[model samples]
Target: MKKLKNVLMVALIVLSIVAIAGCKNDDGNETTNDNKEVNNSVDSNDDKNNDDNDKSDTDNSDNAQEDDLSGLVSVSGSTSVEKIGIATAEEFMALNPDVTVTYESIGSSNGVKNAKDGVTIFGTASRNLKTEEKNWGLTETVIAHDGVAVITHPSNSANELTKEQVQAIYKGEITNWKDVGGEDEEIVVVSREDGSGTRGAFEEIVEFEDSLTKDAIIAKGNGNVQTTVAKNEKAIGYVSFTYINDTVKPFKIDGVEPTAENVVNGDYSISRPFLVIYKEENMTKESKAFLEFVLSDEGQMIVEEKGGIKVN
Candidate 1:
């Protein structure tokens, strides 16, 4: 009876071992199938994500070339340097056919204020901004250098005037052209509007703050000042060298002509930097790229070609 019990015990042990092995084999097959499904799902999701990323990249590139710059970039200010801005804008539009840049020939002060108020993406200034302008969240980039030319109507044969004489005329101290050896006509003073950057430079350089309070015909811009001086025989106006041509004659200041070469070499007395202002926070990639192009050698060449002095 003891022998019979031992055999039964051995048989039970063998059956238990086989059952455990079979359960392990079933679990192993189930785990393998589960792992395969998980891997396939992971791979499919990864491929879908990769495709989405690729599509996003492609869209960005196309947008950079098309839709991103499809709107107008408003620029204003610095009548002293409007021609330069206009010419640059023309070329810039051509390169970035997606962007249309429109610049107004407003005076420099208006330009600074407009840019500060977020009315314009860029502001042109023939002079630097004052200390208070920083509060407007405006940052400036010097685009070019320019020299102010004292211009008179072509009929006036007076070739030049000393700095003192030019200052006196603007200050209302010297009223007659005859006093400066031109003609016997009263000097019709044509000056820029009060907010003009060129006007600030003119006053600062000649120390005319105390004396320029008198009334003078206030033309809106350098171009307007040139036109006013050219049309009126008795007029004398300060204009930028870029605007000087046959219609008006530029007067030598202290025996120096306001030529591009002179201005570049620091021989010109009334030279100032031309600036473009933009807001620090509102800058976009398009704005950054456009500005980068302007500051490049290609942009500087454009400035020189447009009869303006290149800064870099």
Candidate 2:
């Protein structure tokens, strides 16, 4: 009886041991499966993040490449804007040596014509584009506001004149400076050639379009008009406000001086726009960048330094 009881106890102990070993094997498999699932999930997230980062990098790289520029840009237009344009070009070239910018101080009408015909990338005009010109799909950006100064030789005795009197003088009604309280000499009417932006603005402002005296001397540019008046003691002419130098004397109109401050305050009635024209649909990358720089704060500063009133 004792031996039978001892055998039963041993058999029960072996069964219990086998059962514990089975539980441990099942737990180990479940733990390994859970670890694999968690690791796989983490790896999948990491791959997605890497792909997004790669796409972001590509976009940034594309932008950086676009910012890199190199090419030639041609600008031509109003002689009035020539000095400012050249200064702007020089500064732009200094900053971007890879890009070459050239400016030609041809007449404003030629500049508009060239820009419309695609002969040049940019055109400068002292006057606003005509109504017919807007139909050509050309756009004008007013970069500055300038005054048309009524200038005379410093030897003249007249300090100022009424707007009507100035108009009459250009129209040949007041042929003698003595008629407007000047010397007894015959007024040497120095006028700009036709198609000159200065001429257009002056004629339009003075309300004497197509009526300038036939005997008036036609000068090609502002410098020429200044030169003519500078040497001739009896000469009277008009120029852009910037050209008002010691060589020539500026005449006040309607009790207001031809000054930047006067123009800004609307006291100067002979103010005109300085225009930069371009084609709306077909701007090159370099050309667009150049225009952006011209409108920038630095560019406007250059405009002021060059004796123009900033648009802003």
Candidate 3:
């Protein structure tokens, strides 16, 4: 009976060991396999996210390359070129968000001086450079053509004036409006001040020869001249044709109107060149690009829209 009991206990011990091994084989292997599969899925997802991030970075880099033009283009000179310069600069900058363009309207001669002195990246002149200015090695780029319009208060009766009459009025020889077929009011001659591009061109066209009448009221800038004439019914002033508004009447010169078409077609004789001057040796890349743009079809369109003659 004791031997039988010992055999029975050994059998029980063997059965317990077999059951423990079976549980481990079934549950532990399943947990390990599940963990392995989850790890692989997580790795796959991480790889996809990393690839997406890399592609995103590359796309941004390409976009940056396409719009990489960045620099300052500073243009100063010629109050008469104000509209043209501003229009072109604005459009250029809009296309190149990373670039900057600025225009400062001082005067034509000063603009040329600034270009030669390297004080500005570009300078504007409404008239051709003087012989000495050209001797300074500065180069001129003609952007557009402008006509000098002789304006008066809208109430004036005269619609046309000969070249000689316009010259005499500026020279103080024709002080009364009646002398020019207008009302008998005494003419208030408003002239642009010294250093003005409009004044230079007008004086040259009419053969003022530095002989502008001393009695003329000197106004600065086209706006100023426009204002002076618009307020005084007897006032007569000359401005860029672009500056003409309903506030003032632009007189016909020898039966030709001061229009862009007339100027480009060569019927408007009292015209001048609007120039952008620079030192070729010292020109920056940005200025060259801007000058090219100013001469381009889009640039000349702005010139025409601004009431200047298109060069192209």
Top TM-score: which candidate number?
2
Model 3 lDDT per residue over 1-312, tens place: 999999999999999999999999999999999999999999999999999999999999999776677899989998889999999999999988778999998999888889899989789988878889889988888888899999999989988999999999888898898888988889888998788888888898889868778889999899999999999999999999889889999999999988888887899889999999888877776777788888999999998888788887
List lDDT for all candidates, in order.
Answer: 0.85, 0.90, 0.89
lDDT of 1 at 255: 90
On a 0 to 100 scale, what is the lDDT of residue 59 in model 3? 97
The alpha-carbon deviation from the true structure for residue 77 of candidate 2, after best TM-score superposition, in angstroms, is 1.2
What lDDT score is found at residue 269 in candidate 1? 86
lDDT score, candidate 1, position 87: 80
Worst 10 residues of 2 by lDDT: 280-289
Question: Relative to the unseen true structure, what is the C-alpha lDDT of residue 296 in candidate 1, on a scale of 0 to 100?
Answer: 84
- What's the C-alpha lDDT at position 173 in model 2? 93
| Candidate 2 ranges with C-alpha deviation above 4 Å | 1-67
Model 1 ranges with Cα > 4 A deviation: 1-69, 213-215
The order by descending lDDT is 2, 3, 1
For residue 227, give model 3's deviation from the true position in Å. Answer: 0.9
| Alpha carbon lDDT at 120, candidate 1 | 86
Task: Write model 2 residue lDDT over 83-160, tens digit each, in one string.
Answer: 888998889888877889999888899999889988889988999888888898898899889999999989789999
